[model samples]
Target: MSFIQTLNDAWSRTQSLLCVGLDPEPAKFPAALNGRPDAIFEFCKTIVDATAPYASSFKPQIAYFAAHRAEDQLEALIAHIHEKHAGIPVILDAKRGDIGSTAEQYAKEAFERYKADAVTVNPYMGFDSIEPYLAHEGKGVIVLCRTSNAGGSDLQFLSTSDGKPLYQVVAQLAAQKWNDNGQLGLVVGATFPKEIETVRGIVGDMPLLIPGIGAQGGDVEATVRAGRTANGAGMLINSSRAIIYAGKGDDYAQAAAEAAKKTRDTINQYR
Candidate 1:
């Protein structure tokens, strides 16, 4: 099955838009996992198992592993998700943006090496920077548009000759031009619900990966009302620190599960 098909199945099977984000920060790991060489994988695998019932997707940010030289653990965690939580799409949140062979290698890293179902990419360098990822048939290529940070306005809000913000232009291009293979999706932050609504209008039913809900304080009601498809599904709402770090004790996995369940239930209430 294709990435989108698998994602659709996940939404139906789990009745969720929640995309659990695995951004492991060792400094914040629980006491039980401290000093373990495989702490990153162990912590994340435990959380994945505990919360798999409520999540429609899992996004593991690559930088979290690379910074600690834990790429092997990252690979193991993704493999474990595939093995134990079938149908739940794992998105490698690498946000890679390069051109030519470099971009191809990045694509290889995300699709072949990491074995992620989907991967996020930056659109700053235009179509050529994104084309290589599209070469990997059926793999999801999510483009960054209208990011959640306040500093994003420095560039995203700047008006182009079309009198629309740069972000909107990116949305138009991604929807009409870049999505020929139907493998494209957009990352529109949950913090910007109005922009999310606007992007949804431009992209129609294209799936959106929305971050900023939990630790970022994005309003769930506003995010759902703005981003959901007409049928009330078209989002992979992500929450990282808020869900994964819900507890710091031995029962951290259980705490993460409860947090994920509450978040999934709250999102459903609005949907």
Candidate 2:
């Protein structure tokens, strides 16, 4: 199946729009798992296994793995999710962008090397930087539109000649221009519901990978109210620390599962 179909099937099967983030921070790991060479992988595997029942997808932020030089572990984690969870889509949140050959290599790393079902891409360099990922046929190319970080507005919210914000323009380009294979999606932060709504208006039913909930304090009710598509299935609300680090004990996985379940239920409540 294609990325969109896989994601939709997972959403239907799990009855969730929640996407648990596998961002394993070494210092924040459970006491027993901390300082171990395999801590990152072990922690991520546990989170995936625990949240699989409640999650429509799992997003592993690549920087965490790269920082620890644990790319092999990331590969193992993605493979494990595919083997065990079946339909749950794994999005490698790499946010990569570059010119021509470099972009091609990045696409290869995301889809071939790590085998991520989808990936987050930075579009700052324009369409050429994004096209290589789009050429990967069934894999998803989620272009960064409106990000969740505090400094995102520095570029994303700038007005163009047509008076539309740069993010809206990105949404327009993603929906109207780049989505040739029905695999394009947008990254709209849940932290800004109004921005989410604006992008939704431009993109219609295109998938939105929304982050900044839980730890970043994005309002769940506002997110659901603003980001939900006409079919009530476009948004993937993500939570990292709040879910994965819910506990620092041996029962951390269980606590993470509970957190995932609660996040899923809370999102569904508003849907």
Candidate 3:
């Protein structure tokens, strides 16, 4: 199936819009697993096993694995998720962007090497940097639009000559010109609900991968109110630290599972 079809199927099968971020920091691992070369993988495996039932998708931020030189572990985790929970999609959050040959290699890394169903791409270099990823049939390329970080306003919110924010211009371009494959999506932070609503209007039914909900203080109800499509299923609300680090003890996996369930249900309530 195509990336969009796979994602929609996962959402329907799980009845969830929650995308658990498998960003394992070595420092945050449980005491027993901390400092181990394989701690990140072990922690993520347990978290995925526990939270898969409540998740529509899993997003593994590549930096966490790359920082520790755990590429093998990252590959293993994706394989494990595919093996055990075939219905759920895996999005590799690499945010890669470059020109020409480099862009092709990044696409190869995300879709061929790591075998992710989707990837987050940086759009600063414009369409050519994004086209390689889109060239891969059935793989998704999610462009970074209005990010959640405090510094995102530095560039994204700048007013263009037409009185439109840079991000709004990006939204218009992405929706109109770059989505030929029908696998395009935007990363709009949940922290910016009004922005989410505006981007939603621009993109129509295209999916939005929203972060900053949990630990970052983004309001869940506000996110749902602004991000959801008319059918109430166009957004994937992500929570990382809040769910994964809910506990530091032996029951960490259980705590993460409970947190995932609560988040999924909370999102459902507003839907």
Candidate 4:
């Protein structure tokens, strides 16, 4: 199956668009796992075991593992998620993009080396930066359209002399013109619901990777109302620290599951 099909299939099974972000910040880990690499793996294992049932898929932010020089350890974490959740997709949230040859190597590392089912890439480098990822059959290449940050407006909303904002231009390309292969997805901020609707209009039925639901203080209710299609599908609302660090103690995994359930149930209400 292709990446879109795989993610949609998972959505069907879970009845959810919730993508739990397993960003294991060392500072937020349980006291037991504070400085231990093995503890980080164990914590991820516990959280995956606890929250997999409620999640449509899992997104492990690459930076968290990279910060600790624990890239190899991430394989173990992904393996654990697969073992426990079976077909649930794993999206490596690296937000990578580069020019030409460098892009190919990055795609190779993301898909072959890491074996992630999906990855987030930046579109600023143009289609050449994303073309390398299209070779991975059934893998997702999500382009960063509008990110979730206060400073995001710095470039994303800049108006061209042509009158369209920069991100709208990105949406037009990522949705209609640039998707030579069907493996494309777009990243839009949940914090910006009106922008979500605007981009949704541009993308049609393409799956959207929505960040900033929990930790970044995005309004979940508003995002769901705007980002959902007629059937309220095709959107993955991601929550990381809000879910993972809910308790920050021994019951952290359980807290994470509860947080995921709250998010899922809340979105289901609008669905």
Query: How close is each model in CA RMSD to the real structure?
Result: 0.7, 0.9, 0.8, 1.1
lDDT of each: 0.94, 0.91, 0.93, 0.88
- Which of candidates 2 and 4 is the stronger one according to lDDT? 2
The parts of candidate 2 lying over 4 Å away from their true place are none
Q: All candidates' TM-scores?
A: 0.99, 0.98, 0.99, 0.97
Q: Give the Å error, residue 215, model 2.
A: 0.5
Candidate 4 per-residue C-alpha lDDT over 199-224 given as tens digits, one digit per residue, 9 for 90 to 100: 99999988899999887989988998
Please report, as a residue range, the 10-residue window in candidate 2 with the lowest summed lDDT: 29-38
Kindly list the per-residue Cα lDDT of model 2 for residues 103-201, writing each as its tens digit.
999999999999999999998998899889988878998999999999999989999999988998999999998888889899999889999998988
- Clashing pairs for model 3 are none
- The candidate with the higher TM-score, 1 or 2, is 1
Q: Which 10-residue window in model 4 sums to the lowest lDDT?
A: 32-41
Q: Which pairs of residues collide in candidate 4? A: none
Model 1, runs deviating above 4 Å: none
Candidate 1, residue 4: the lDDT equals 78
